[model samples]
Target: MPREVTSFSNALVKQARGLRDKKNRKREGLFLAEGLRILTEARETGVLPQTLFFSDASHRLLKELIDEVEAAGGEAIETSADILHKISGKDNPQTVLGMFPAFDTALDAIDRASAPLWIVAQSLRDPGNIGTILRTGDAVGAGGLILVDDSADPFSVEAVRASMGALFTQKIAQARWEDFVAWLRSGPGQLVGTSLKASADYQDARYEKPAFILVGNEQAGLPAAYEAECDLLVKMPMLGRADSLNAAVATAVMAYEVINQWRRR
Candidate 1:
């Protein structure tokens, strides 16, 4: 029988609650992974869970899922809805929240990747943008996501929720801007950046070899100096009044463009 935690003051509940803040995530090197589907996907993708928290309110809906986790050698515990709210920071906490290690990787060591598409993000601070980009990266079978400078933490609760477990499924790494630039120049893949001014339309660019595409922040876009580093600069044409697109939406459109082009060849 999984131990039932009746109160919101339990040690585990307190720790899970910490995931609502980025500081706690950084300090603990952990994050709260909520919902059955996301947690299950994380488990399937080789994320070793620290604990499996099941709410009493959610247990009826998730009993079988909880059992499945236990079957897979994960620890299962029961806590009430109040405790779950304290831990998960949602109006209605999902039936399940699993604590998983904060995944961290470096871009320097890997010489090349097997996947065809690649994504590079520059100082993207929005959690939603980071999550959506990760999802798009995974959807297009991107080689990985490159994080430069102070990008949003993918392990944060909002990003994890937004990603729908795509964060766990994708390969992501953090590096400095200089290192990323050097990587692009040193590696065999073509590095492409998006710009509103560039004459080259995104659809026109050919994604040959292992290719890397840079996704800038929502408002600022990539810095001009970095823009010069692109093997080529590409832009999405806009007929509407809006001068540009949201970073995440732009990234999705650009990523799948490469996917479509690659499929033809």
Candidate 2:
């Protein structure tokens, strides 16, 4: 039988609410993933949460998820709507939210046989953009996401919500810029960077097998030093007055081109 938690003062409830902050989430090694899609993905992927919270109205709807949690040696709690809202950080939160363990894939986890494609975001700040990139990476069957330097939290609520469940399927890696560059140089892949200064159009660039497409921060773009490190630097044309594309859009454009190239071979 599942437990009932009515009070916001409950330790579990308080801990769930604390996940709203990045620091707390890091310290706790857990984060909140809300909505049915994300929970379903988590269950399917065997990334079961440590705890599951659902309101009375949601109990019937989430029975399968609740059962899976319990089967996986996790706990399920029936909580009040207020507590659900509190943990989700929304005025009217989803009836079901999960407290899942955070995950990070090592740089060496890539399987070479898969012809892996990795998306590298350097000093990215937009949670939504990161989420979209995760979704796009999953769509293209990319290897994983590499968040370099002070990139936005891929586990953030904004990013998770934007991902629409891709967050569960994708592998994420975080590293400092210098460390990541060293790993890249040592790794087996073509390091491609996107830049406005590059004379070559993106279409002209060859996205060979095992490619790592590096995208810059939204405002600053890729630094000159970093751009110079890439095996090749490509640029998307700007026929209109706009100087650049949205970070996510630019990544998606590059990702599909890479996928297309891989498919052709």
In terms of lDDT, which candidate is strongest?
2
Cα lDDT tens digits, model 2, 79-110, are: 88888988887988888899989885566564
TM-score of each: 0.92, 0.94
lDDT of 1 by residue, 71-158 (tens): 7676778877777777887898887788877876778644466787788899999988888888888888886788888888888888
TM-score result, candidate 2: 0.94
- Count of backbone collisions within predicted model 1: 0
In model 2, which runs have C-alpha deviations exceeding 4 angstroms? 56-61, 109-115
**Inter-residue clash pairs, candidate 1:** none
Please provide the root mean square deviation of candidate 1 (C-alpha atoms, Å): 2.2
Error of 2 at 232 (Å): 1.1
Cα miss at 161, model 1 (Å)? 0.7
Q: Which stretches of candidate 1 lie over 4 Å from their true place?
A: 56-74, 109-111
